[model samples]
Target: MDGLHAPASLALGIVPRKAPALDIASIPRFWFDNDPFKTRFFDALSLLFPEGEKFFIACVRDYRANITDPELQQQVKDFIYQEGQHGALHTAFNDRLKAQGVQVDRILAKQRTIMFDGFRGKLPKRYTLGQTAAAEHITAIMAHRFTHSDVFASAHPVARALFAWHAVEEIEHKAVAFDVLRTVAKGNWLIRAGSMLQVSVTFPLHVVLLMNHLLKLDGVLPNPQVWKDGRRWLLGAEGLLRPMLRDYLDYYRFGFHPNNHGNLAKIQRWREEFAEHGDARLATDRTLHG
Candidate 1:
């Protein structure tokens, strides 16, 4: 509309699938590379989704009436279904974590308290959507990175499938929330940036809290090597964050838009792989193969 983002009728092509047949009951506790840090790193993120998606859906739905465009309104519906399914599957996955002695309910309770009690009732509606938009961007970038990040090279097939499915959907609809934000509260890049700042800090902080708890449970909390490797894994020269920092920083640009960071090929691969119920290993980025 402003020569910045995609058009209102962008046809996001969001396809919400029935729950994937993830055999959560049998997944190894250390599903990612058999390392506690890697496994719980994503597991902790799973803890965020159910609550996160709920908040994200609410933020978008609250402003739905303001969206007069039929295409965007339809995208919003598909977005809700897609995000809702993500939360459901993650919840199923998180519930499975309890079998591994993770105290998932307690962790979920903490997240719920923070979202429902702490912010939902208090934050202004527009800011909530802004934060949602910011978070979607962060997720879209992270989802994009996962496609190529070595962090997931040795990740179990089930775990890989979860991330891959979630990633594709995130990429497809990445613009919806931000477009909604632009529609209802146009030209609020500052708020988008502020919300990005808020989510950027809070998100990793919560993940750290979760990883700490999970590691302590595994009796790996005192392992200096885990922390060292993790810092290197995330912040090191060739680490996950290093390669992704530029994309993350793009959110601050005056004309930033998710469309500018497209990864359609990867999205198509995952969609095809999952549609046939093939092991998603083929759909993952080439990093896994190389």
Candidate 2:
């Protein structure tokens, strides 16, 4: 394996095996509860999913074409399965927004047209994989920062759990795509470098676009609460970005190792939190309608 190291592999030896299918059933319910700010944020995120899903699907398709190692191919297949479930869960959540009279379909349609179909011809498979790797790195960092921050810690129980669950999985699978590309591409720095560059650029652009969408949807552009929450979220990005960049450099120097351990204690804490307050019935409730 291109990025595998014995020491790193040993460190990760204790990490729990990931299921082939994500337990979408465990996704928290409080995420749906109506607070104007939270709902606005959810709507903005919903808008991003169609494009994100397409991007993942594209990368997975490309990998299927190029990958030859059976074990690595199986890992990629598992990653795709989990990503597809993510798309399904978010799509369901988007439907909830539409139920609340949000203009979700129109926005997603436009995003799909532009981000998926329109850009498909311009971006090549290697570039797509690079972007995926970059996004994964960004999410891994965000997962770490979110576990440590009070902003996430103090949120509604369900909201906090939702972010943490996603974060844990991000950390768990962070190396999968990079491993795939490293194996197939073999010392291809364009994918690695391009991914890093795109991560730095596209993440902020998504945030800006999200804020703009939220402002137009809720007419809360100037609301103090919006600014306060937005500021906190942006500040949280620093914690995520710094360590992630460090890890990216480390990966280049040490090579990709699947055995690297993250803050597993945090994942445990989040699971414990979920067990305490997470009601399966409540989480499954569609009563909120949005």
Per-candidate TM-score against the hidden true structure: 0.90, 0.71
lDDT tens readout by residue for model 1, 1-290: 12112222332477766656677676788888888887888888898899899999998999888888998898999999999999998988888778778888888788888876877788888888888998998888787777643456687776777787788789889999999998766738778888889989999999999899989999998888999998887789977777667778878998887777744554665677666754554455432322
Q: Rate the local accuracy (lDDT) of all candidates.
A: 0.79, 0.55
Q: Kindly provide the TM-score of model 1 when superposed on the true structure, using C-alpha atoms.
A: 0.90
Could you say which candidate leads in lDDT?
1
In angstroms, the error of model 2 at 57 is: 2.8
Clashing pairs in 1: none
* Alpha carbon RMSD to native, model 2: 7.0
Candidate 1 lowest-lDDT run of ten: 1-10
**Which pairs of residues clash in candidate 2, taking residues 3 or more apart in a chain or in different chains?**
3-256, 8-259
Instruction: Show where candidate 1 strays beyond 4 Å.
Output: 1-12, 149-151, 276-290
Tens-place lDDT digits, model 2, residues 144-255: 6555444343334544444445555566667777776677756387667766686667656765676566565657766677767755644455432343455556544445
